[model samples]
Target: MKKIIKTVICIAALISAVSCMNNTKTLLPNVSGKAGEVIIVVGKDNWEGNLGNEIGGLLARDCEYLPQREPLYSLVNLSPGAFSDMFKLHRNIVIFNIDSTVVKQGVVYRTDVWAHPQCVIQVNASCADSAIVVLEKNGENITGAIEQAERNRVIANTLLYEESKLGDVVAKMIGGRVHFPVGYNLKKVTDDFIWIADEKQYSTQGVFIYKYPATDEDPFSEENIIARRNVFLKEYVPATAENSYMTTSVFVKPGIKFLKYHNLDFVETRGLWEVYNDYMGGPFVSHSFYSKDGKDIIVLEAWVYAPKYDKRQYLRQTESLLYSFEWDEDGNDGK
Candidate 1:
């Protein structure tokens, strides 16, 4: 039985290798589509039926922590016949294949099928009912996969046009670095706080990095993190109005979740920020984690101020910068 199991595993590995080779394309075109857009390929009947509704409801749910309501993804449906080569190059795609001849009734995820840096997820089922079952079981997984792809694209672009000088300053200040894009510049730098921003005429994307002494208490708790963040913002982040400073918006209580990504455990907070005596406000997301030496709790926060336009893409682009953080190998204590 053990020998049989080993043989089966080897066969599976060989099949996976062959499948990868077949899917890889040389000189693939770059993906086309606006950020936060996804193309869904399905039959007209299926798309108009319960399957389409399910997919739409899952993918089009309102994004969290935004001041204004915005769908998580801008979904575009295309019939199987309309999914031509032009549509195939979209950055995000979901294809539904419902047929009686489908022996493998499951979801298959592939990347860069027809274009570089693309996410293509195909759901195969013997019938429409079976397709819903598969989606219900893996809804969160599907959403997460697409979200990661979007973030990866932003990170890739940031790395390509990175501001290396700002990264060096962050490493020297915190013993870690986050890749800032070309437009962002250092706003302020101090012993324990660093501010960076990409200020445009109508919109502003900002990031704050601050550290405090670690304690044995529940440091990652929502209340504690908010209190600390408010303290930093009130001290460092100020508005044009007299004595006005940024603080957590009490109108919407911030939400906190612990997450482990890229081997780093951190507490994430999402909510809105407002100036104490001013009208300026927008959405913000922060990641609080310990320094490499575990001596300090470092908080990296990204906030957006875009009253004139939709903020979903702006917030996402700035938030992706926080995910690019990495600890420097050189033993700099960030002194």
Candidate 2:
């Protein structure tokens, strides 16, 4: 069997890693052309063969471009402002997703200075490109794909404290589809989380995983725990039992430190999925860390059916909140 390597990272780590080089900033890169005059056409289909070529030709009929061979985009003569404005105007027109195939919303070229900003980009030999571009890929689930893509773009668009550092982080994701949710008010999230009163010490973040079968198997039951633990330690993998019941994990950012759950039973949500024939419960083993500036705490969590193993992928697939914790500020007030 192929090895399945799983890893988890919070928003803090993401930002910190991306901005690993302290020289980058939130302002858009310098551009050499006009942004408003450009229009970036994302592929509505798997534009691998002649399809992409045809679309490029059709768009070129109206727009002009510099003489170049093997263009990465269908159009590129306009400046950053023009490119971003055009996307905002007709982004909904070409939103498409073909089954098993890939449809891409070409990245956006955006900058703060909208009026006739000089443009500079990758092709420039010695000038800095003052623009930010991001891609939107429509998956098999088109609506969900777009929604997620929008969220990704929104997050990629946000330039917070040391805000300019985000560009470097995204540049690394040049050919990948790692998506993130966006637009929620990111002010100290304080719901379900009662309080964080400690200003002197770092708070804790954690996750807990429990096994629940799709069939009628009580996950919290003692018999189920013993059976699953044996299967995991002896077999090195989770064996599927009847009814399809499986495991899940919950992530949280706490104001105070949390103790390990050697043996604890948690109440299930009042949802249709919770009412099953068999259910088993378990405790939590959390991984804790501090924020970049050390003002906030971050938790690294996963479920261990056996020592040194976690069911993080399962929770991310089923519940969106499974891997989510708090995203705190660096407490850095830029001077």
Q: Write candidate 2's Cα lDDT for 257-307 as tens digits.
A: 322222321222211111012443223333333334333222232222211
For each candidate in turn, the TM-score is 0.91, 0.19
Off by over 4 Å in 2: 1-140, 157-335
lDDT of 1 at 7: 100
Candidate topping TM-score: 1
